[model samples]
Target: MKTSTRLEQAIKKLYVAFHNNTLHPECCKQCAVGNILNNTDSWKHLSDYHGALELNYIGKVNESFGRKFNGYSPSELLKIEATFLKACGYQLPLHYKNSKPKHPTNKDVLFNGLTKVVTFLCELDGVSNVMDYTKLFEFINEKPRFQLDDVITF
Candidate 1:
């Protein structure tokens, strides 16, 4: 299968998990993605950009929760990150010196991509509209407002 196909399928799986309220790793006793999301401390790290989804962040989460590290590889982490962020129509948080992506990133493109994901999520959650769902997530709290014509380099 193509990479895009695989990603789409993964996102669908994620949607199901969310819909079922089984997104927690402990809920199903499953993999790293659920583990990370279910742990509030870990999720905060990702949300706050305290660390990337790398070894250090995992270690910190593990320490915070008193859970032993489960020895997931870097590629595994990247795969998980890609799937989760893509499901939210987001890329990995950029933490480099310039805080820019290697590829061009525009607000319209991101907004559109996010709209697709958010719309699907809304439908799954039985939310009838886009604005309603965004309000629930409070997603724009710290981000720049995305206008239809706004262009961002990252």
Candidate 2:
């Protein structure tokens, strides 16, 4: 599939996850994205547009929770993130910096999936401004729950 096509599919998958509550909306907040990016170099190339979209989605989640940001441990957040990635038919890149690694088909799948999702989010919604990472993390910490049966389709 083309890069753009992959991105579209990824975004759709994320949307489905959000709708189904499989991926916590707060996970995409500005703070959360920043945290993930800071912790992992994988997202360094993410454009401002994509960041904004994520922030917006995170803000929406915060609104729903009546909070600004929810906090969670790095390991806990990783688990949630991994679940979303898996739902989107992708895996977590082994290393943050080497998002687009050469080896391993699984890594390629994840890199492609994340790239598509980020691009779609940047273009489709203005997320950067709406996101608050701190609030997002707090929300996650408050309620760390996932419904395994809740399937997210693209």
Model 1 lDDT per residue over 1-154, tens place: 1223323443455455555544432121222244433323333333334224454565555556655323333334334544434533334543445232232233343334334544443444453533342333333778645543232111
Tell me how far the alpha carbon of residue 24 in candidate 2 is from the true structure, in angstroms, after superposition.
18
Worst ten in a row by lDDT for model 1:
23-32
Tens-digit lDDT track of model 2 for 106-129? 434444434544543444333331
What would the C-alpha RMSD of candidate 2 be, to one decimal place?
16.9
Q: Model 2: how far is 136 from its true place, Å?
A: 37
Model 1 lDDT vs. the true structure? 0.39
TM-score of 1: 0.26
Clashing pairs in 1: none
